[model samples]
Target: MSKRPINQLSLFTPGLDTDPAVKATMREAARSCALSREQLCDRMNELAGQAGIRLNGGNAKQLTLATLEKWLNPLDREHIPSARAIGVFCRAVGSVEPLQTLVAPHGLYLIDEQQVRKLRMAEIEEEMEALKREKQRLKAGS
Candidate 1:
């Protein structure tokens, strides 16, 4: 019986390489998405609204296609999306590549729930092997 959702693995992509070009990553993520730029912006704004997200100076404004274009533009470094916007964008695009790229340079990596369970299972196996070794040592001493 698991307390967490069984489908959490869908949220993460393990073993993905890092890319330092955040703007390029974002651009690629958006470009590869099934939604058009206008549709993507619409989806981003919809998600932001549902989550009560506000950008820039905290005013309630919907994300515009022009703003998204600026963020996607490599030369327009000044208009990088906010963390909230990034979250919304990732959700809207159905890909975490942009977020993963941002975190990779910081020595952080994303792992799925299945990977975490596998690691824990391996650790427990190691502990069991250590106990077996101790049992053998005890029998020899007896």
Candidate 2:
């Protein structure tokens, strides 16, 4: 597939209020990171380059420290980062907390490979309980 600009504006409603917690999560992620903010942006850009991704407007630079600052700034809602930027930020900082924070308000969550099995087991247990209840109901009716 052909490469597309990563920062295309989609799903944004003008004048809509955004959750402050999203930016707070990003700030916490940055604070917990061992690398400085400049280093973090550099690493994000490097990763984007490796993935053959570029920001919108076909700009060669994927991210910069100033851009990153705007993203983390609570007052600068207009400078929101793209989904791709968030992904790279998570990868660079070695945490999914920001992503988790974004999805939590929607009743969604992120789970790692290790948690998949546990989730499946819980599902299976629920199904078994449902079946047992059905069997008892049938026996009583018979």
Worst 10 residues of 2 by lDDT: 7-16
Q: What are the runs in model 1 whose C-alpha is more than 4 Å off? A: 1-20, 58-60
Error of 1 at 96 (Å): 1.0
| lDDT of candidates 1 onward, in order | 0.78, 0.76
Task: Mark the regions of model 2 whose C-alpha exceeds 4 Å error after superposition.
Answer: 1-16, 55-60, 132-142
Residues 64-140, model 1: lDDT tens digits: 78888988887775677877787888899998888877776444667779999999999999999999999999999
- Least well predicted 10-residue stretch by lDDT in candidate 1: 11-20
Q: Can you write out model 2's per-residue Cα lDDT over 10-127, one digit (the tens) per residue?
A: 3542222343566677888999999999899888888888988764334545676888888888677677777777788899899998788766544457999879999999999999
Give TM per candidate. Answer: 0.77, 0.73
Candidate topping TM-score: 1
Q: What is the Å distance of residue 6 in model 2 from its true position?
A: 30
Distance from true location, Cα of 122 in model 1, Å: 2.0
